[model samples]
Target: MILKTKKPVVLLFALLLSLVLVGCNKTAYINSNNISEPSELKEALTQQNTVIIDARSAEEYAKGHLKGSINLTAGELTINEPVKAMLAPQEQINKVLSSKGISNDSNIFIYDNSGGVYSSRVWWTLKLYGHENVKVINNGVNAILDNDFELSLDIPSIKETNYEAKEVNSSYIATIDDVKKAIDDEDTTIIDVRSRAEFDEGAIPTAILYPHTKNLYSDGAFKSTRDTYLNYNDLGLKKDQSIILYCKSSFRATQTALLLEEAGYTNVKIYDGAWLEWSTKDMPKADKKPSTPATSQDAS
Candidate 1:
């Protein structure tokens, strides 16, 4: 999502009306093969090495969750040391996954109560650490329940493993310096995926205001690849150009970044420090200050 050059404009805009009628289905996602239908989990839960992770609060996990799914909240995978809700270190990630009984070969499926905002962050975290076997459950817990899949109140016991995270996948991340360079880079686009109200309050200069909510359909499921590509391409983002995304932290950014890649955008990166770090620095900004300080709800 780029300025190097442009390609033939996608002609799928007219198909939106027909797509809206089919609702959410596995066939809808052609760009990324990382989505799982709720019904697919019925058999997935029975397979060895299959681990379903519920990326919600402990309280939410206690009330109900997909059967055999383990609970791993955002707090478990992130830190607030350098910035608000930055992703945890590789060592911490290894410990957390091992303690949760997630092995290197585990076929992991992650979900939240109903949306990708939280769960997708976890999915990106796994990918950053080289856990490519993971998939995010579309529509999450609500859809799984609606599909008549079983939920359990019983907390499963864990058999911890000796987990090791791979070398940091730098492609998914962008440092503050990288962002500074991109600010004036002719070929790069930095998107601020925060709310319109937040964007009005303050934002990095030149950052486009494309909220994370736009990534979902009215039903909270992700839009199809064609829809996502078409709608996002309206920003004149090229599939081959560079795109940088950020939100309050990078939770919301990861949500869009992953989808952008899924929609055939090859060069998407998340500014993990996001507005939190940028606001802290003496960098050039569009306004005086940000409106709201981040809350735990906004952090990933």
Candidate 2:
């Protein structure tokens, strides 16, 4: 008689071993080059090819903004598409960039008054759309103002150019199916970057609760590269581990995603639908917490 059970057991062992080896061969990486200091930016802005994008509200930009900077809000870069804040289509991004006089070769610098949150959003969107020559101002617009850079109400004349986006790389984004598969995949980690209060209300079951604020320092700047690497590494996530990030609408998730990718995490993807789409579906959610608010220092 053939021993059918023994063959099945051996195949399972072989499959598991292959996965283990793949994880072991992957290397961890950490870098801090994407962040730009104010002094360096001050000199760079004098060059004709350098472009500064102020990612603030129109009202705020009208009040005052960096001289020679183009005013573009994060809202201009998204679509409802049934899911609010989803990254807009490539053609739409092209129009927005072209209208702002942004070319693919421009040495672009982005910033916002609200820490790096809004600026990071723009930076991530550009990177997703294949513009690799971009940087997020460290600590955001405040850093520039603190350096005595004056804000101008005068709008510099913009000579629009044809700024066509390159073919998008779909690997940077995730879909509902990816999340479902990742939920059961040993190699993947699903992260929920919502506030603790929001997370406690309900989150993807098994998703790690890491609030977006955790990526920021007390003064609103992003954590150093080493600190950011340490924070995620503490979660037992290997550098090569597949990560799916989502927040209420994945906006905050983008901030975390940017930091992770900058630190050399190669497999990061954003769940564009985020909780908005996930909650409406029949998928599982986390157990509700106690009536008392989360007291953890990292909560929200």
Candidate 3:
């Protein structure tokens, strides 16, 4: 009789190898070059056809912002989809970008006041929509002013461009079900990208604590690629393993996921609902401080 068991075992091994390769090939849309320094940006402005975007509230932008920069907040890029803060419809995104004179051919640079936090959100949105060239200025508006550059109160007249929307890249974002599967997958690594206090209070089971600030400098600039790699490498993360990132509401997770992806990680995904949906879904949550106060950090 034929040995049926041996053939089945060989098939299983082949399947596992194929899955690993797929994970390895899941590279992020952006890379390390997406991070720009103030001085370098100043020089680039002279040569490159660039569109600088200030990702802050309108009120904040009115106070003062970089000259020639357009104001585009996180709210404009998203809508109330199945979950709050989900990316907006393609038409909306295209309208916003085109109105701001942003085009697929332009080198887009984004920055925010609160560290690189809000800027990273805009970066994620653009990449999700398949805008090819985008970067977040290291530090932020302060980085520009600190270099003795000029700031303007006047809003520049925007000559709109035809910013088309490409196919949405769904691989960068993860769902609650995907997270549940990751929890059970031995090769998956779940990272908690919140503050130390927030992580100490409660987190997903088996998730590692890696604060988003750890990847940023006091000046708000992202650390060098070598430094960024070392920080995550300390956690014994492999370059090819699948990683799921989550924070209070998913903002910090997107920021942290970008850093990890820039540092050469092959597979990185953000849980858009993050802790908000995870806790509500009756999923496994571990609280290191079970007696902590009920009023914790805001999800946003």
Local distance difference test, each candidate: 0.81, 0.80, 0.78
Pick by TM-score: which candidate is best?
Answer: 1
Count of residue pairs whose backbone atoms collide, per candidate: 1, 0, 1
List RMSD in Å for every model shown: 9.2, 13.6, 14.5
Per-residue lDDT of 112-177 in model 3, one digit per residue for the tens?
877677888889888888886888887787778778777899999989989898877989988889
Please give the lDDT score at residue 163 for candidate 3: 89
Give per-residue CA lDDT, model 1, range 17-82, as digits (tens). Answer: 446554543335432468777656666788898999999899999998877889998778899988
RMSD (CA, Å), candidate 2 to true, equals 13.6
Q: TM-score ranking from best to worst?
A: 1, 2, 3
Kindly report which residue stretches of model 2 are placed more than 4 angstroms away from their true locations once superposed.
1-33, 288-300
Judging by TM-score, tell me the better candidate of 1 and 2: 1
Give the TM-score (vs. native) of candidate 3.
0.81
